[model samples]
Target: MPEYDEQDPVDISRPNPARMYDYYLGGAHNFAVDREAADRVLAILPETREFAMRNREFLQRVVRFLAVEAGITQFLDLGSGIPTAGNVHEVVQAVHPDNRVVYVDHEPVAVAQSQRLLADNPYTAVVHADIRDHETVLNHPETRRLLDFSQPLAVLMLQVLPFIPDTDDPAGVVATYRDMCVSGSYLAVAHSLSFDYWPGAVAEAVEMYTKSTHPLNLRTPDQVAAFFDGYDLVDPGVVFTAVWRPDKPVSDEEAISSRAVAGLGVLP
Candidate 1:
């Protein structure tokens, strides 16, 4: 891990969604402010941690499928949070050492930690940029070096779109990235479900996030599916995060308890 000094640009006073997510994943990269905010969300919804874990599991499963089954060698992970276990490069490189990956994030901690972790791996790199800025992320030297737009690569947006409010045109953002790739390129998305789908403290939890660096913008299933407009969804299209091609059997209760929806699509 990279050392964070006083001169670092990270603001420990405010809660960051990436750090809060790291806290939920039991990662040590988060600060007290993030923990307090995450704890508040956990108090409101005890299953928040479970949701985070499920989202990570979903990411691993999807990336593994893309690398091994779909035969994709390049990956562009947008809004990738603090590097945790089973990251995209780890999962893909296990299949083929040369598998390339570019991780994009605006969080200083996430970018720094990723840069440190990926220093020795020439096949991977970290781009410190906001995912919504498709031009910046796509044009970054690392992204251009590691990912080829003409080839079939997987673009991952797990648990990312919620941070992009509708006012920013999140669907258009996806479309922008999608248009840059070839027909066989893939798009994987996992987003928190709207309060209507998950009644109870979900609204309150979202309200709590409003105070954080990235405010949560939960969307309906239809709204989430709109991101895959130009692509054909894979089997079991747009289902609960835990139920999307789970490596292990998922109980009905576990599926219902999942607070988010996930799906993988291929440009047809």
Candidate 2:
């Protein structure tokens, strides 16, 4: 972790989206308010935890593919929640110890926890900044130090875009990052997608996020794909989380129930 004051305040009064996600992942970094919110979401959608885990799995697989196949040695993970099993650095570094990663998140507690977890890891660093502030995130010392823009890199926004509403120009935000990277750089994105299979459950989950710090802004597959406007989507274009290069066979039921879609694209 880069040297910096870790005195950022953590508001435990209201539920934080990141902490709630940590709670869903069965991590101990969450507070009571987070757990309460997570439980309510679970009540509305019994498969909430399953969806979260599957999304995580998708991220892990994408990281491994980029590291081993694409030969990407650096990663910028936006909205990387409380680090859990199969972190980007963990997955990539295991394949190539030289891989570097920079995690960006606005949540104070999330940043603090990440800082602690990566204290001894020189190749990884966390930036406590809103991903929407592209300039700050791109210019951060840690990011500049660890990532080489001149070379190919992987930018991951899995399960994070829904937090950015349309008014904020989420698509433009993505395009800015895309333009910043050199050609052949990769962009891995996953956002909540509502299918006909369980519209009611999707509505309930959306309602729950409205009360949290980051409201949900679920998008269709086409809408999500537009984020990669100038990039070439990799094979198995934007599909359900479990259906995206899964390690094992995914049943149709499992694919539809995942309720999230992911895509990998390369800048041309």
Candidate 3:
């Protein structure tokens, strides 16, 4: 929990996965409620924090590969949480200074942070919109301003899809975004893994998170792979986030606890 002044709104009262994630990234935007809730679930699953760190590294490596290897200059990051260390824009723009990026998140805090950080940068913009609203997200004025849909852009859905359960048409939601992208566009995905390592811990964590403003919906490797249905996955496909493209050799203990699976795919 962070010490807050009266300016802090009640949005901090309820637990939010985004703010919790920001907390994991060692960012200062989260509240005591979010921290306490994250601490509760993490106490049950101690690996959660390690897994989050690996997931963030995966995002950074994947963005570098997409920008340098795939020659992508535009990026659309959905479910983008707080603007913290090594954000998508930072990584991508480092490789290509003119890279255009649009960060989208439904959280008010995330939106406010992005808007503040990106205010004067015409090459980058953040919009407060749900990724599920494919049309609205694609046609957003900010989206149109910062992205050229006709050109190849890297679309990142890291740790976002699980929130929209299959019953709500998660597959269709993915396809809608894929359909909008041009051939050779890239897709990056990362999500929580559902495995047998910690049944009680996982259930308790999910139960706690599901009660939050943003829901949790962990998925199997198959379900995670399915999200790449129509795309060509890059090398070392669909592995745990730590194993995706490790900046350096990751220890066994580090990899084992990194429960999330993340990968990059290219639309052919």
Candidate 4:
């Protein structure tokens, strides 16, 4: 096992995206700075917290759908934040205990939390790696041990793409994972959408979060769907977070993300 120590924290003085997101989800792993920043973002866009919850629901729905219907037992959750509420392993393992899950994140706190939460559970683990390093993530020790590349796996990029700038090849990051797993593999992804929902809502939210460690990169619907080029998108293709195979009927409140979008794609 590689020594999972602290990395280059360019500026730990300000709020971090992962930590701010954790704060939005009501998780305890965040700092006061993160909470303050999240509060500011919420002030700019009241729907920020609402979108987070809906995204969580979306993650659970997709995990269960893959585990039960797709018969996928391997899951690689990229940019997975602090474990809270309904997690991938909790949801999938409930359906099939043997299901294996590996969460990858560059956030130190997130990696630590993932380790603590999954220590006794051999089937699930977390690795510290950047989303841009697709090759390293694919070959990570925890990931290699828990996931079988030859079998069908779910590549989860939930609400993670926006963290990486288009200059870093965000689409390429997803396509790399898509091409690695075997033909029956699946992909579940969601990205912060552009300002289509509320004229200037997206841009305003981005401006609010600029104080955080990373700058946000919200994408348009067309740009978001392009991430699924190699695979066949499942029904209700590339729709808003609540619209993708929603577990329960989506209320007007849940469907608010005519702004953010999500979908699942199957390889074959």
Best by lDDT: 1
The C-alpha TM-scores of every prediction are 0.97, 0.95, 0.93, 0.93
3-102 per-residue lDDT for model 2 (tens digits): 3344667776778888888888888888788898899888888788888888889999999999998999999999998989889999999998879999
Q: What is the C-alpha RMSD of each candidate to the true structure, in Å?
A: 1.3, 2.8, 2.2, 3.2
What's the count of clashing pairs in each model shown?
Answer: 0, 0, 1, 0
**Would you list the C-alpha lDDT of every candidate in the order shown?**
0.91, 0.88, 0.85, 0.83
Question: What is the full ranking by lDDT, best candidate first?
Answer: 1, 2, 3, 4
Please give the range of 10 consecutive residues that has the lowest summed lDDT in model 4.
Answer: 1-10
lDDT of 4 by residue, 1-268 (tens): 1233465343458888988887778788877778888887788887788788878888988999999998998899999988897899999999989899999998888888789889899999998999888778878888788888887888999988988887888888887888798898898888888766754455767886677778888888889899998899899999988888776687776676545899999987
lDDT of 3: 0.85
- The candidate with the higher TM-score, 1 or 4, is 1
Better of 2 and 3 by TM-score: 2
Please identify which of the two predictions, 1 or 4, would achieve the higher lDDT against the true structure: 1
Best-to-worst ranking by TM-score:
1, 2, 3, 4
Angstrom error of the Cα, residue 23, model 2: value is 1.1
lDDT digits (tens) for residues 1-268 of candidate 3: 4444456353766888899989877898887889999889878977778778878888889998888888999999999988888998898889978899999998887887788888888789988888888778888998998888788889999988878887889889888989999999999999888756444468878899877997788888888999998999999999878888787987876666678788788888
lDDT of 1 by residue, 23-121 (tens): 999998988899999999999888888888989999989999999999999999999989999999999999999999999999999998999899999
